[model samples]
Target: MKHNMFCFQCEQTAGCTGCTGRAGVCGKQANTANLQDALTGALIALARTIQGKQTVSAKISKQIIDGLFTTVTNVNFNDVTIQQRIDAIHRELPAGTADYDMKKVWDAQEDIRSLKSLILFGIRGMAAYAYHAMILGYTDAQLDAFFVKALCAVGEDTWGMDELLPIVLEVGEKNLACMALLDKANTETYGIPEPTTVPLTVEKGPFIVVTGHDLYDLKCLLEQTKDKGVAVYTHGEMLPAHGYPELKKYPHLKGNFGTAWQNQQKEFDNIPAPILFTTNCLMPPRPSYADRVFTTEVVSYPEMVHIDEARDFTPVIEKALELGGYAEDQPFTGINGGHTVTTGFGHGAILRAADQIVDAVKSGAIRHFFLVGGCDGARPGRNYYTEFVKQTPPDTVVLTLACGKYRFNDLDLGTIGGLPRLMDVGQCNDAYGAIQVAVALAKAFDCGVNELPLSMVLSWYEQKAVCILLTLLYLGIQNIRLGPTLPAFLSPNVLQFLVEHYHIAPISTPEEDLKAILGE
Candidate 1:
């Protein structure tokens, strides 16, 4: 177990195990990973100090969130910035508190390590949601307090599975609340998303492609470049922004740029536009396009221009105008070669059609529903998602969200009754909506959600998907199918507990899985 460093927070960890060498599978160097660990330890120290306080300022809470979120996979690879955050955490800590060693958890007994990793990674994911909601002027005291409480638990030396299991499940409870706060902030600020059809063509002009999940950053960029003749295109999780009415209002907000985050290195190689990364899903830029990269908010790399709190996007705009974009409209297709893809099927849109959907279900026109979504990565076996969706019966509907949808989003699966067979359910945070719709459908059916013929076949990449899975487990929903791989952090006993209690299974082939799911 001796190594330079240890990391297994992402689905694509080296060799389906911990990345314990010079670099992680996501290109995060050992130095950066160590710094991240140090920063996380400092946050835990700060949390241990603040957990007993009656009043903690919003500023301090935000710092705790920033510290936790920076360690999430693919978020911050800038060692200097990571160190700066760690120093800030040290400055804020009271005199006697010492930084917790993260290796303690990584080196703990198997079952204890597994449960604690769930709590730590789960809150790392929750912090991203809290950060987003905070950006929109929304804050919840319970969510804020839970961050400190959970971090304190992660830092504790005496807590075993008996003490940690409740906190692990509480991460799900609080994350459910956190997602609700973010959903409110998003819907209120940007308006509820409507079904939007986004093109794959980049119009012939100066355009900037914004990736990652931060919609507020996109809003800021849209405002700053409104009359500058720069068109903005969505990439990865930002694709869901197009469904929000306030965002699509910008006339120059053009079509989508590339596919999922995994394809960026290849897809972005030759694009004649500057790309702005607002959040996660950042790959190390290639030399051909590295200079064209700009980051804002928490997403940072060494050489990229970091847009600060002032929210000015002038440098990004100038880069786009300098590139001048394509001489003619360059049409790009998704992996499936479709010329266009559509999104914006939030819970609102789906629930609005609930009566009709229920009628279709009762009448046997829609036999079942499948929710197949989560993060997408460069790892193999992802084709399982594509093939699984393709093999689903025509009588079933596929509701998807997150970047995982990009694998099959462009494929037109025709329609059941009046609704499209393939429905894009917005971004990763919109898992709240997926849960909402399921609960509503279950209520209407007079049964539990797991009894509604809905199957959750998820593909996970990082901590955000980890929290979502935790939320699903918290609700006691069973029979979820996950792939292309199970997490490396889940110990044999912990994973076995899940399989026996929740019936969670690693995905088999689409042919066999389809047969089993359909009870053929």
Candidate 2:
């Protein structure tokens, strides 16, 4: 039997194995899936051609990074964009070079397939980081070169677990570097994020909702609309924008408009605003608000107005003004009905109060630390994260990132040691920030990171979380509790290896897991 498409790269894969029907669980169609596969194959071909290049240039890095990132889940749904990337790779490759068949890797030995999947998906996530950094005019030659090497390794015929396992971990190593590059670029370009409280209300008047994870795109939109009588509200990963010193300086860069990306279709229904998508987590828009959607920076959808490299958001601005927004301020609340959400507790802000945090811990005022964060999904099991946060003891500090915090970001978790009990650590790319806080805590206590009073309770929905998990594993962080479900691509033996070596556990009920984590 011929399959139209086969994908299991995300947490929501059908049957927890793969999506093999007309569309994936995330709503990706068969045609889009096939096109994405072709795009990946072309990237592998380009990597094979450049396998031993003595010198790779910046142009080569950007294309490969963007292409791989485009294939990430929910990033690009436009067949035209995927085909354009594939065609560009074909033009860039040497004569007679051929694309590698992804089917070979998919149908390989179970262990081999598992290992290669890690490499491919891990790099796909890293590519998002590289792409973000590139947009800010920062590119690390070594980091860029790893994408070529890793992609080549994934396509290699002779590499088995012995060889592929090391490459899988190396994806973590390179992802760390890639994230650091992005952090530097972001902070230097937009200034370090300070702790700021973002309201859930939308102020009266014309406003555009900027979603996705691109700070540069947000910066451009803010600059273009500076005094244009239009307000800018962040959505999803863009919520951290309010903490940036440069970004928050703009009076019109107002509060966040909705919850996580998964709820956009419902939240945006006939909404009187234009939504600008700078990166991933874009759902297929409903007809009610489809005309108000505008995409930019590699995010494309059929029939949506796309803002190109010129960085002009006049079209979006005009649409927002034409909508005229609400005559009265529209008050909004988070999933918990809280009036506001707090963010910007990035490494800089967190570290500023490190002394107080340490003292609080020593005094037994703060009992534990839980990094409960990742992508939020539409699955019913996702409610466990919200409950997990709510059930976490008042003495435990919760540090969250990505869209996962939307599960409970608005909750009033109280505080300890002059720090809010729950802290927001910027976007998924800022996993590096969480790592920094972890490493610093370990050093303060003179122990390994795993020995610190910290636990990583992660919820993965897409490939970016895959790379972040690899980074955590590469750093030897252990006893991580991952849920609401495990990735279906991990063969039994591969899953056992992780379980035995790292004690990785699928999350249980909130009460049971909390007891186990706290040794109660």
- Predicted candidate 1 versus true structure: per-residue lDDT over 1-520, tens digit per residue: 3237789999999988899998888999888988898898898888887788877789889898988888899899898898888888888877777899988989999888899999999999999999999999999988888899999898888987889989988999999999999999999999999998999988898999999999999999999998899999999999999999999999999889989999999989967899999988888999999999998878899988899989888989999999999999888899999989999999999999999899999999999899999999989899999999998999999999999999999999999968999999988989999999999999999999989989999999999999999999999999999989999989999999999999999999999988888899
At residue 238, what lDDT does model 1 achieve?
Answer: 95
Q: Model 1 Cα displacement at 267 (Å)?
A: 1.0
TM-score to true structure, per model: 0.98, 0.98
Model 2, 307-361: lDDT tens digits are 9999888899999999999999999999999989988999989888888888999
- Model 1, poorest ten-residue lDDT window? 1-10
Alpha-carbon shift of residue 268 in model 2 (angstroms):
0.7
lDDT of each: 0.91, 0.91
Candidate 2 lDDT for residue 208: 92
